[model samples]
Target: MATLTSVYADSTIVLGPLATEAQPEAYDLCEKHVNSFTAPRGWQIIRLATDFAPAPPSEDDLLALADAVREASRAPRPAPMPAEHRPRPGGVMPGPVTAPLPPPPEIAEGEVLRRGHLRVLKGDKE
Candidate 1:
């Protein structure tokens, strides 16, 4: 995979490293597409000599990932609300109580084999 930058003023196309963010004027090309690219009339193509290998995770990247994981794992504290809106210490929450869920339907022939939300059925033999 490669990132390409087209210079309209210079009429040149440059192939370089993959960008971390999406650019308004840059394009990310696949290996097959990049290898078989064609420029417009009067346009020149320039390929950088740098290897486009996947970069290893840096210390800062690892530390940032760890911090994010820690933040996400920690339970979120409840935000303070107005006294009138807050529920009583031992009272039930003031909302409609949900009815108990009904049991699932009984399984049959076609339902014997299931694929996700679909059922595979056996066709009648001639």
Candidate 2:
């Protein structure tokens, strides 16, 4: 993609699309619009090299990829659980089910305190 800057004094606009990060001050234009762009009166337009070809992968990129592959190969795969211990298809386990916990006790009228957007209230002692 082309990067458009407004800081130039001659108003020399680079007619191309932005190739990298989208900056707030830069304008990205498509190939069709770039060709049709025209400079205003008293302003000069300088056409810079519009090379959009991606650079070849650097040594660092190749090294990082190799390291990642080596790390992945070294990682231990989880052993499958025994068929006897596996859970049923319907999500039912083979053990005694425990009851859910009771809800917290209600806070007293004056015991509640507020600080900014947060509130502090006394909870059950246990």
Candidate 3:
């Protein structure tokens, strides 16, 4: 499966890798359609064939792996950070030191919504 994009102004058509995102001008085609595809007369078609097979690792890749392993093998990691330097998760986080005052001692049980001084209470009607 691949995406076919046409450039009318340049009279060109591109048959390439499937688009990551759909575009109004691009058409998604299956293998059969791609194989039997044709370009309009006087127009140019640029067909792109991509091989997805992974290539064998080269010497640079081996060297990079060796360097990483060497780094990993290096001795005792820097001594554990002192207790004071360690992050105290969820401890003493700075904010309004005083918590929002309790909801006015949970006034009346039927309270629905409260404004400054007025509270919309649930009506007794069902």
Candidate 4:
């Protein structure tokens, strides 16, 4: 029987390299897993299947994936107002036409009249 070298989880658990004619220890791993499992490349990761070795994505592939994720995160968010809640063209806005300003503190009748006249002259009467 042919010996198999398979990995499980993140660790390299070599299955029996049991040779039909030889002992179990004669079972050395295949070239692919040998280079992958032993070397500690930062970005190159590998997953192995029982029958065949899973191809490790190249550095360019990983970089492209990372760039896509970053771009998606930075994409512009939708505006706060929903389409239905948005003010239609030529339609009145929902909030008060203008919020009322706080009234001035109580003052003598003469002062109040003078302030009123000044407001009118400045075209700021409300």
Candidate 5:
């Protein structure tokens, strides 16, 4: 079975024959279907064939793990913020800050047909 992983910064995807090894057959398949793959901008064939061992997670991963630990240790809910300290409208509490505006009224049947023709000409409608 084959699984496709993405090619970096490109629309084309790379196919993995198996999770273990990089398959050259996959690249050839993509080049055949994708039009953009020509001589110069030809698809990159990455062969994870050799003894190329993937690098371990870097310092960022370690830091993130530590941060997760610190967060989990703290109580789930923090002290309730005072009402005065909380965000509000006009720098103070008020009614609902925003309201939904009503939608435009339905157009007349004749207007709908005219608009449909215009949309068709503009390639805006299916």
Candidate 6:
């Protein structure tokens, strides 16, 4: 595999064969199409020296991956509360309690209007 790229600034196109060495500016092309390269009528084609060796991973890429893994490992884990202080699985907690309020007085037939779960009661005239 090789790469072919058009450099608009210099009005030139380059065909570079793939090598272990990396050329930052070149785009990779399929091996089958290397011999079929062409350019516009006025453009010039430049052939770059190609090396077949594989490029080594950059230091920055390795460091970034290590930093990401370290950060994920450092995330805070939730602390478990003591059994006595924790709420019972299905029971309410003990607290200062008062008598429950009585239910509302029954509504008279004509004075109450019901809609869905709501109720409207006519006020007693003074």
Number of the top lDDT candidate: 1
What are the per-residue Cα lDDT tens digits for candidate 3 across 16-116?
88787879999988878888889989999898876322346889989999999998999668888744332222345344434433333355788885655
Q: Write the per-residue lDDT of candidate 4 for residues 1-126, one digit (tens) a residue.
A: 224443434544444333446554335556564454543343333334344443467899799999999999999998898445444333556764444444554555434233433522224458
lDDT of 1 at 109: 63
lDDT of 6 by residue, 1-126 (tens): 667777988889987755446667767776556657788888998877554333567998799999999999999988998455434333465763344444445656765755435678788799
Q: Residue 79, candidate 6: how far off, in angstroms?
A: 31
lDDT per model, in order?
A: 0.76, 0.62, 0.74, 0.49, 0.46, 0.68
lDDT of 4: 0.49
Candidate order, TM-score descending: 1, 3, 2, 6, 5, 4
What's the lDDT for residue 81 in model 5?
Answer: 84
Error of 4 at 112 (Å): 58
Write candidate 1's Cα lDDT for 1-126 as tens digits: 789999999999999888889998999887777878899989999988456555678999999999999998896978998455434333465665354333344557655555436666778779
Sequence-dependent TM-score of model 4: 0.23
Candidate number with the higher lDDT (3 or 5): 3
Candidate 5 yields a Cα-based lDDT of 0.46
Each prediction's number of clashing residue pairs: 0, 6, 0, 1, 0, 6
Superposition error at 52 for model 4 (Å): 5.6
Model 2 spans > 4 angstroms off: 50-126
Model 5 poorest ten-residue lDDT run: 113-122
Could you tell me which residue pairs clash in candidate 2?
Answer: 1-17, 1-18, 1-19, 2-16, 2-17, 2-18
Better of 4 and 5 by lDDT: 4
Q: Which stretches of candidate 3 lie over 4 Å from their true place?
A: 50-126
Alpha-carbon TM-score of each model against the true structure: 0.41, 0.34, 0.39, 0.23, 0.24, 0.33
Q: Which digits, one per residue and each the tens of the lDDT, describe model 5 over residues 1-91? A: 3334556665445443435556543433332333233323545544333332334678997999999999988957788985543333224
